[model samples]
Target: MMDRRERKRPAAQPGSRRRTAALLLGSAVLLAAALSARPVPHEVVVQFGDDVSAREAANALASLGATVLWVNRSEGVWAVRMPDPGEAWRLYDRGAERVTDAKSYSST
Candidate 1:
């Protein structure tokens, strides 16, 4: 008679391999969906200099291909969206006092 410890272990079932592949494929699909849902054309708040008027600032930013979402006249800030992250530097060059990422102060 063979001792229990001396017996060979059974081979892995074929179903387990299929289940693992399925799990990996599902994870990949979910990851792709998540990546597609991420935000694009990042939002930013551009605070204009004291010398710049709201209309002037808006026109300037629009000329740079920024989409103006909102304008805070009292605060002298314009909330705009740009495709490239580095576009904030251009806003500063255009007479923006400060340019901040809208995501930082957003509730959502």
Candidate 2:
């Protein structure tokens, strides 16, 4: 009885609100999962001066009950995993110039 141009269209055509709510709920779940995730206690990279050798650096870390995961002989840097983070100071006393966390750049 009314002209098509004068009649108003349905606000959302139906089911659009449900789809939008599902999308929002999925996004919230993903956000919560990401926020709860944590990184492992990755090893530390010990940097020594040029005067230090790879073997010497390894030995220094070994004395602290740490394990040498890898050795970069050319750069005089060793990736070592200590029992605790507090051992970084002892590394300085043992002749280490710098100690930094060895973090992963890529995610699996």
Candidate 3:
């Protein structure tokens, strides 16, 4: 039996909030570290859609001063050299699909 004037008991311990905050901070740091562990790719491979012609894709890449390291015209795939990963957007604008990092490929 509880008194009407008695306050409700707190659901959580006083230290619980600090534990949650510390866990969140630790998780964030772990995620940031994990993401940073991967190497940044120096090049990317692009697969152009069927609607996009090989010549058109090639021209667009050339205009961007991007080197076409390797190309499989029949498959509509092009491995383009890009020093900056952010610059990969130029290829996307030209109708590229499955744009993936090709750091494993040799520039030669």
Each candidate's clash count: 0, 0, 0
Better-scoring candidate (TM-score), 1 or 3: 1
Per-residue lDDT tens digits for candidate 3, residues 4-102, read 679786699879999999999999999999999775646788888899887898887777667788888485888887656777777778888667778
The candidate scoring highest on lDDT is 1
- Give me the overall lDDT of model 1: 0.81
Q: Write the per-residue lDDT of candidate 1 for residues 1-108, one digit (tens) a residue.
A: 999999999999979999999999999999999998775788888888889887778777887788888877474888888877576788777788878898775423
RMSD of each: 10.4, 10.9, 11.8
Global lDDT of each model? 0.81, 0.75, 0.79
Cα lDDT tens digits, model 2, 1-108, are 899899997689589989999999999999989976743334888878878766777778888778778776485777877777666678886668878777842212
Best by TM-score: 1
TM-score of each: 0.57, 0.52, 0.52
Q: What clash pairs does model 2 have?
A: none
Off by over 4 Å in 3: 1-41, 73-75, 104-108
